[model samples]
Target: MVKGAFDGVTVLDFTQGVAGPHASMLLALHGADVIKIEPPEGDWGRALGELKGDHCAHSIAFNRGKRSIALDLKSPDGIAVVKKLAAKADVVMESFRPGVIGRLGFGYEDLKKINPKVVYCSISGFGQTGPYSKRPTVDGLIQAFSGMMVMNKMPDGTPWRQGMIAVDVTTGLYTFQALAPAIMRQFRFGEGCYIDSSLMRAAAAYQGAKLMEWVFSKGNPPVLYMPAGSYKTANGYIMLSAMRPHHFRLLFELIGREDIANDPDLQSHDNRIRNAAKIIKALNETMPQKTTEEWIEILQPKDVFCERVNNYTDYLQHPHVKATGAVDWIEQDGMGALPVANIPGLPRASEHPPQQYAPHIGENGPEILRELSYSAADIDAMLSRGGVRAPAPAVKAAD
Candidate 1:
């Protein structure tokens, strides 16, 4: 078997939701042993979207490549078990409110005492020392707080949150980026570091260019390219980008608007932006005359950048997506067959079967306890006392 980049690293993950779990999942994918510590019930993420037994799409998506062990943090045995794990962990991640993890005695200061070289990461909606740090927040809240909703305004000019958990997922990517460098630093210099990541900051970073544009333009940033936006076709919508003057000319000429294409007032990009209303009106009047596919056939041949606005199904079924192996179908246990998109720069799911498995609540509890050198009786005692939880024994069907 090939060794992974983080083959020998061990991550103690105490994060339940998308952001923290996403970062830990990336670590797991890179060949780290990520031990997910859940509550007695399960990670709250497990209930996100529609539940499939103990897992949901969000949970399955972000928690793959990790072992789960449910523990009651309030219990003495649970705290003891965590401390033991912390002492040996290369990285520790938590997504609790600012002081909640500290109060539970698993804070960076607490863990660093036992393992000076542990890379501790804390994920939250806001930074640790912010005025709004203690305020409860979710992906949508962060989207609203970070100006993403405003930036993603609807056609009717109403601020709108994205259809997906954009902020949470972005936060996870940022968190992983931070962790990778911190781990590298730790490997080089025998030192540990605390990573304070938050959805608010990550969302802002994701819109960094937009924020700068807003500041530079004093809130009225000029349109990027006049003839670049979604337009309704006879049957469906098509998004086009006529970024260059030639492309704009081609688009207009193809759409029977050669007059607009050749107008001196719209030759330069800045001039086009100034006359956006005129260009947009022409497109609106003409684009809907043809179907999205017809428009693609016409515009594409002229070197105009345009594509049919595709939904998930359309994207999944696209010939280019299949030819490139962009998505792989995997038979996820309990979830039936699932289409898992291939992450860039990583091996396909078929190449790493173990990394494709997302654990059920406390699915690896007994095995994890055994590795901690706990006797079978001790494991049972903890389970009975609610300090730990493992999957219930499967009842055999009688023949």
Candidate 2:
């Protein structure tokens, strides 16, 4: 079997919720040995959606191919165990509020003393320094603060948050991109660096183009083009991107609006924008004459840029998606069968099996402790004292 790019790497995941876990999970999917350290109740994500034995949709989705160790971080023994693991880890990722990890004695500065070459990444809502650094943050809050709500405002002028946790997910990807290079630096120059990534920064970066445009236009989008919006078809909506003059002309002609296409008053870009309401009213009345598919069929052949607005089900069952093997089906032990998206350019399904599902809290404690050279008695003692937790011992069949 071929090895993954991160096959020999080990990641110590001290994150919960979306951002930090997502980054570590991406590393795990690429073959990193990621040990997820969770609180005694497990990652809070385990309770996010429907739950089954410390597993939930969010947890399972972001925590595949990793081990879980539930420890009482306040306990001296628990702190020692984490430090021991950090001493040998290749990367450390945490999403604690600023200064919390430092108070816990596992901050990047503290861990660097134990493992100088460890690539440490810290993820938060805001960064480590700033008046708002300590403020609690989630995707919605960041979206509102980052002007994303304004960008997604409804036609009636109501600001709206994006349906998904865009900031958290994007921060995770940004964290991975930052840490991956730091890991390479360790191999190339034996140098490890601390990374500070935040949802605020990621959210801002995600809307970089829009933010710059807002500044340039003094808060309103510039009227540079026409026929660049979504229109309601007979059954559904279709978004059209006819920014160029030729494309706009083609769109008007295809829609059977020859008068609008030939109108001298609407020929210039500024005139078209100034008369947008008239064009929009015409489209709103005419577009609904044909269904979304009918519009796609007609417009696609005419080299017009238009596509039906598809929901998740439509996207999942799309022929092109299946043809590209974009998702994989797997049966997790406790979570049942689920569809997992595959990373592009990687193996569709690696040798990692269903047993690689998200683990119960402290499911791998004993095994991890054993790897740390702890004796059975010590492991039992830690479990007894509530310093560590492991799955119940297997039952033996009576003869």
Name the top TM-score candidate.
1
Per-candidate TM equals: 0.96, 0.93
Please write out the lDDT profile of model 1 over residues 156-186, one tens digit for every residue.
7799989999999999999999999999999
- Candidate 2: tens digits of C-alpha lDDT, residues 1-399: 457778889899999998999899889877889999988777887777777666777888888878988899999879989989999999999989999999999999999998999999999999999999999988999999999998888878899999888898999889888878888899899998899999999999888888889888988986557777888988999998877778778888998998888878778788888888878888898899999999888899988999889987898888988898887678766556677787775566534564347776778888999999999999989989997866653311111
By how many angstroms RMSD does model 1 differ from the true structure?
2.3
Q: For model 2, what is the error of residue 322's alpha carbon versus the real structure, in angstroms, after optimal superposition?
A: 1.0
In model 1, the runs with Cα more than 4 Å from the true position are 393-399
Instruction: Judge candidate 2 at residue 115 and give its lDDT.
Output: 97
Q: Against the hidden true structure, what lDDT does model 1 obtain?
A: 0.90
Look at candidate 2 and tell me the lDDT of residue 322. Answer: 88
How accurate locally is residue 64 in candidate 2, as Cα lDDT from 0 to 100? 81
